[model samples]
Target: MHVIIFSWEYPPRVVGQLAEYVRLLAAELVKNRVDVHVVTYHDFLTGAVEEPDGVKVFRVANPVRTHVGILTWALTLNQEVERAAASIYYQVGKQVALVDVHDWHFIPAAVTLKNAFGLPFAYSVESLEDHRAPPANTPYSMSIKSIEWLGFYEAQRVCVKSEWMRDEIVRIHAVPKGKITVVKPKANSWIRDILAMYKSMAGGAGKN
Candidate 1:
């Protein structure tokens, strides 16, 4: 199956565990003989394409930095996502079966692809609104909440990392129970061993 994954982060530019999870997931998908292409924002401003672990990764420019306010920033991010999705959809041809998005931030890209090519898009909701603490008066939080609702409405299947998120989406967003799927993160043994080695080295250094 040709799968186009849209994520906000990926390996070598990790903001959190999601990037690592995406890298591992894409690698596993490739091993299973699936053609995976990932599109993410290039933090270092490098427009480069590379194949890592049989999965193609495309890093594009983030156009949201020009926005001075939080709302505009979110809008610009969605705009860049639309632009990138268009390019990927055109290049990948019309045989693509699925457009899988890693988070709500990549919803615009998934929606764009689905709308353009009439494909089914699935969403992996790593976090849900009820899972997080109550929002403050900050504009960032407000903007996120508003845009996230659109993602929920757009996804054909909403995959959650935890049971809590699955229930939260069903109860809070009123998404049908049939539309949600609970999938846990698969651990990569090689990556775990490498982390253990790094931790051991750090511990030895701390003792010195």
Candidate 2:
């Protein structure tokens, strides 16, 4: 099985746990003979593509713009991810097995990829725009929230770290109550949860 993962950060570009989590997940998947491809941002000195531990990683450059807000940068980053992914999808001569996308940071590209390839994407929601208390409804904030809504609505699966986040997803995005999987962050359980999520996603795809 193959999974194309999208994230804003990865090893050597460590934004948070997301980067480290993805690194561990990809390495473990490779050991299990699963083809894991990561699409992320290129940090200061890393090349566009890195093949660490047999996990194929494509990093797109997302340089900061002087006047543009973070959303604009995110959109531009999505374009880079999409272009690289399209190239790989054609070169491999196989449809991507599943799209494992992380948050709204990469939703623009993930949505396009899913629609273009007719694949179901599993969204990992780390946080939500609406759950961030006051000023969370500002223009930029609301825009990101809408993107999150679209992600939940379009996803075949949703994974979250805590029940609070799961509730936030259901309440804020209006996703079905039973659709979210709660995965703990402990090292041992996280991998099992991810594997189960992948199986669920793959099984759903088969039904389609």
Candidate 3:
């Protein structure tokens, strides 16, 4: 099965756990012999299309020149996502079975991909209610809520990390309970090995 993943960030440009999660999931999917393609922001350094962990990673340039605010950035990200997804469709020429969007930040991108290819898409709500939380009077918050609502309506499945998030989206956002699935996040074993190696190196240096 061909799966296209959309995330705002991915390694080696780690912003948060989302990037790590994407990396881990992609690796697992690759291990299972699934053809996976990831579309994300261009790496600031290489700017080259490369396969990381057996998954094809495509990076697109962010078009927005200035970071006016969160809302503007979100809108621009969506625009870039649409452009990237279209490019992927044209180049790949194979319809994706599923498009997995990481978080609310990638909702616009996911929606664009879904619309452009008419493919089934799933959403992963990494940070729940953070966008809707207090100082909610801002235009950015409203825009986020609107985008999230659209995503909720469009996605075939709403995947979340915890039951709290699933419940919140169902309760506050009025998303159907049946539409939500709670899948707990698992730490990547490769990352654990890397951390252990770093710790060992630090210990050896300390002994020296």
Candidate that would win on TM-score: 2
Given candidate 2, what's the lDDT at residue 48? 47
Clashing pairs in 1: none
Query: Tens digit of lDDT per residue, candidate 3, span 3-32?
Result: 678888888778888898898878877786
For each candidate, give its TM-score against the true structure: 0.79, 0.89, 0.81
lDDT of 1 by residue, 115-195 (tens): 766766777777754455364335666556655777778776677766788887877778888877666565345434323
* Weakest ten-residue segment in model 2 by summed lDDT: 43-52
Model 1 weakest lDDT span, ten residues long: 199-208
Query: Candidate 2's residue-wise lDDT over 69-92, tens digit each?
Result: 878888877888888778777766
Clashing pairs in model 3, backbone N/Cα/C closer than 3 A? none
The C-alpha local distance difference test score for the whole of candidate 1 amounts to 0.67
Off by over 4 Å in 2: 43-50, 63-67, 132-135, 187-189, 206-208
Each model's lDDT: 0.67, 0.79, 0.70
The TM-score of candidate 1 is 0.79
